[model samples]
Target: MSDPHSTAPVPSPRRRVGRPAGRRAGDTTTRDRILDSARQHFARGSYSSTTIRAIAADADVNPALVIHYFGSKRDLFGATLRLPLHLRDQVSALIRTDPDDMGEHVVRLFLTAWRDQNVRTPLSAMIRSVFSDEGAADALGQFLATHLLGPLVAASRRDRPELRVSLAASHLAGLVIGRHILGVAPLARADIEQLVACVGPVIQHYLTGRLPAVPTE
Candidate 1:
């Protein structure tokens, strides 16, 4: 006979079989789910126009979950856009040692990056958004400035004594927009080697060569 005050052995707390409670663990499936949703929304249009609620709905999760996993929309976009290759490191190395052939490197980088199915599909959408929407342009500009340009400048500090990195960067940016994004004639059709051959000198000039002097009185 058990005493009236005696209690039966308590069952151990059962661990959840599926996704953990509160916050899902930082597992691949959760990340993939978030990324899938992000791609859907970002590919549709601009990052600014894509709401967290919409992303959550598409992902089939709570809105708070996105924030919990990715921190912010900007972070989510970055994650989605991040290529497998270490672009900053690669570009930095190219700018430092091959400043003379920066244009070829730029073209190669763009072509390679776009070749990747994951990067290309989303990047195409980003390019479209940049042209069609103001908010997208601003967001993309900020992202590029912070991630791409900033790193390139820092990397070239040793080699670019004159510090004209901006000019070089601008030239590369123009080429990318014209060739890949806009699909301009001739440039779009040109083979990689032809483009590299044509554009390499222009980039070299921007990097280290002196500019033409203006007429003076």
Candidate 2:
């Protein structure tokens, strides 16, 4: 028999030099990989910041394929949230409105969605996840910033569009967290129509009115 050490030395796995060795050759799993990538990114950091290219890189697929399979980042987020809410259609209505009346539309649509049990359960889960899990928070935050507020900002002449988005989102998030999720006293018991009228004006103010100036030196 040849000597035990007769073979030449084997290379040490090439150290995988860069990018932590993302997935490869996803012929059957390309679509799944995109989702996997999206889930990973959404769950890992600021979900609002995750991009199509970033997800594609993670899944070892082309960015175009992400579009092919999911159409857009917002759609991908909907899939990730996996809620049955007619979220895409609801959100679509926001961009096609008169800017001055945008707040009422946003509030009305939000309350309308919460009216359905099928929609509320998953939405509750999404909000709960945002509260309890960093990754989930990232994902939801990203989804709201990109899907909900981004369009509003584009159509807004509001100073500090980013702040406008944050204000409006925070208002809605608080309403849901308190009224729906936590079942706060009067809010939980109030009529949806009442809440819409009450909150709609507030949201419009946030979206369009000038802020009171902070006292300064």
lDDT of each: 0.68, 0.71
Tens-digit lDDT track of model 1 for 1-217 = 7688878887999886743323356766877887898998888877568888888877777778888888987778767776555776676676566555665676577566667778776666766777667655555555544555445545545454334456655566677678878889987888878877877777656655676665699
**The best candidate in terms of lDDT:** 2
RMSD of 2: 9.5
Model 2 misplaced regions, further than 4 Å: 1-78, 82-87, 116-119, 213-217
lDDT of 2 at 126: 61
Give the TM-score comparing model 1 with the true structure, all chains together.
Answer: 0.70
Candidate 1: C-alpha RMSD after superposition: 5.0
lDDT for model 1, please: 0.68
Residue pairs in clash, model 1:
none
lDDT agreement of model 2 with the native: 0.71
- How far is 195's C-alpha from truth in model 1 (Å)? 1.7
lDDT of 2 by residue, 35-87 (tens): 66776776555444678889988776668778877888767766665534477
CA error at residue 190 for candidate 1, angstroms: 0.9
